[model samples]
Structures are given as C-alpha cells and as structure tokens.
Target: MSAKIAVKGLKKGFITDQGLLQVVNGISFDVADGEFVAFVGPSGCGKTTLMNIIAGFDPPDEGTVKVDGASRSGPSAKGILISQHGSVFPWLTVQQNLMFGLNGHAPSNKEQLADHYADLVGLKGFEMSYPHELSGGMLKRAELARALVVKPEILYMDEPFSALDALLSLRMRKEFLRILAEERHTVVLITHDVEEAIHLADRIFVLSARPAHIKATFAVPFEHPRRLSSPEAQGLKESILRELGV
Candidate 1:
C-alpha cells in the first residue's frame, strides 16, 4: 500500500492571552491508501490540530504535509472532514444536504446520486426531513451520506461518534464499518475513545499529553466483525490504554 497522506516533523502553535501555546510537536506519520488509521490522545493533546493541518484546513508552523506526493496548500475536494457534531445544514432537507456538493453534475444526476447515498445510509424515507427533525443517530447518518455522496478519496473523521450514547455509538461504528467495506475510502480518525479506535482502525497511534507527539503505535490485526471480547482484541486494547496512561 502506498502512502496517500504523509506528515513530517509537524509543529504547530497558537498565540494565547498568556503567551505562545504550542500544540502539535514534531509529529509525523503516513496513512496508506484505503487504510483506516486512528489517533488516540489525551484531551487538549492536539490530535485535532494535527488532523486539521493534514486536511489542509490549517498550515503547520514547521514541517510539511503532502497528499499523493504533492504538498497540500488548502482544502481539496479529494478529502472531506466530518466532526462529532455533524455538518448537515439545519435548514436544508437530507436530500438537499447530500446534493450540496454535486454542483458539477447535472440536476438529475445529482438527485439520483443523493438519493442513492441517502438510501445507503438508511435515510431513505427521511430525505425530505431537516436536521432539526432528526435524532442524533439520524443526523450522523445524514452527515455520513452527505460526505460519501461526493466520493472523496479520503475521509477525515474527528470523534465522529462522540456525541451519541454508548449503544448508539456502537451501532454507528458497526454501520460505519459496513459502509467503509463498500466505499473503501482511505480514513483517518481522531478519538479519545480507545475502544472505538480499536474497533475501527487498522492501525492506532497514541499521542502524549499537550504539545503532543506520537508516543506509541499499535497494529490491530483482527478481521472484520471483530469481537472486542476476544482475548486478542482485549490485549491490544489494554496495551493502548497503558500507552495512554489510562
């Protein structure tokens, strides 16, 4: 697998009322094409900062980020970032939200594509519903469908299930896995949930406290429909938790 995204010696900081507030520190990693990678770290540990730099939403004060061997300057259509709060337009119906990014396509084509993804994400009957009318889980499904409808080459998810209750989060994880199996988009996820990282990532990177950098990395070798209760999964989860100092 070749590298789809690469980061080298990344360093970022912000100006604060007190002084300079350093966030990411000398972080580096590569996410392979079609691979699902997750970053786990303490709160305020700069995981999202690192992700934002990689996604071209912000520039690193030092080091570099490259996508497909080219330097990333700004947000690219090839990638999309989804957050825990979701990004659907509250005033727009599910169908309109999904079709928002299909401006380059013909009107009929956009409708067909939006409808296809709306159904795929289990929002078939809610295409006409607005975000305010949907539940937390339904809103998440709508966000996923909206992102997928655009067929981005990479999906950057920042604690995408953090807003849901435990059971809903678990179900969404399973549903997300099923969707990924079919769409096969390269993914980079950031989460404080160790179990979520274990369940969804092909590889996990654990970061240190503030001014974060990779402290450890783990490979999850379990097959799909993984059993979190299995010895192997539990052991890996334990190792990750230990690294996180949990």
Candidate 2:
C-alpha cells in the first residue's frame, strides 16, 4: 500500500555560540499517498534537518512523525531517504550499489532486482560501471534506482540534483518525472530551486528562515509535463517568492 506521512509539531535544536538554535520550530504537514511535495526554504532554515527526522536518521526534539497511519521511531521500511550528495560506495559498481541494501535477500532475487532497476533508471548496460567511472547524472540515477528497488512507499529526497552538471540535471529531472508517471510513489523533496520545485511537485510548502514555521503551502495543480515557461508556472514562482519574503 502507498504510504502517507503525517508530521506534527516537529522541532529540532542544537547548541551553538548563539545559544540553542531551534532550526525547525514546531513545523507540521501531511504528505498524501503518492503525492510529490516540495519543501522550500532559505539556507539554515532546517529543511534538511526536518527531512532527516522524517527519514528517521535523527529524532525530533518534539512532535510525531507518523507513516502509513502508524507512529514511527526510526527509519521505516515504508520509506527511503536519498540525500543531496551521492551516497553510492566508490568501491561498488552501479549494479553492486543497487545491491547494497538487499543484503539479506537471495542472490537470484537480488540480481533480478538489480536488473529490473537498471532498466528502470536506463542503466541496463552500465551495471558493471563504477561510480567514479560514471558521469554525475549517471551516479545519481544509480542511487535513484537503488532507492526505488527497495519499493519504498515513501521517498524522501534532499536536494538530490543540486550539484549535477546543468544538462545532466535536466535529464535527471525528466527521469524523475518519468518514474513518477510509471508508478505513484509518495515523495517529499527538499529543494531551494523554485523552478525545479514548480516542475516536479504537486504541492509546495514554504518554510520561514529560522525557527522554521510553515509560511505557506501552495497546491501546484498543473498537469504533468508542464512547460517551465508557461504563464501558470511564472505565477507560481512569483507567489512562492512573495511567500518567502524574497
């Protein structure tokens, strides 16, 4: 079943020279099953930190992170988190990395899973390719497939495409949209790129600078394969900018 994530009164903090910095201040939101939602905010706004809590890498100082209608303490099989930087092992080939999380599964099943994902991410012939040998986009694709192979009900991504070469970034975005079109998977994406968020998200949540709070939530009701330069797109961007006080 597709997973729906509901986060409430979430808060995170850390001690600094400035005293306790409460990054994500009691932020709350719900992600509908199979919906693509973008979390946009300025730097040091606790966007990533909030994502980490939902992904179960770290616990929230307060509030509840529930998945599929149940309480969650740690990372749940219901979802997979894809961080901004490439997390693929340098020592592993594209195929091998896809096998990283499938350690306990049978060998044959793992091979089947890898082969299926290789084809899914358009990396069929590059299974033996090492991370270092592939281009930036290719490496991200491998990681994407690896995350998808686990068949997570929810996918949490943290600026996964930010550092890619421009052309590669577009290709990856198209691939991302393609994957969504194939099978509906609940996805929460943390990004600062307004245009990217407009193109990929069904809804966008804007967070305030520090002690982050939900500034605004925009429902992106555009059809898929939306043109980036469309009037509607421009309007959405304008509204988001205004919300962030940019």
Q: Point to the candidate with the largest lDDT.
A: 1
TM-score of 2: 0.94
Q: How far off is residue 206 in model 1, in Å?
A: 0.3
For every candidate in turn, the CA RMSD to the true structure comes to: 1.0, 1.8
Model 1, span 65-98: residue lDDT tens: 8889989889888999997567889889999999
- Candidate 2 structure quality by residue, lDDT tens digits, 1-246: 534888999989998999998888988888888789999999888888988998988999999988878898999877889998768899988888888888679998998899889889899899998988987778889889989988888889999998887678778889889988987789999998888899899999998999888999999989989898999899999999999888
Q: By TM-score, how accurate is candidate 1?
A: 0.98
Pick the TM-score winner.
1
lDDT of 2 at 27: 85
lDDT of each model, Cα atoms only?
A: 0.92, 0.88
Worst 10 residues of 1 by lDDT: 83-92
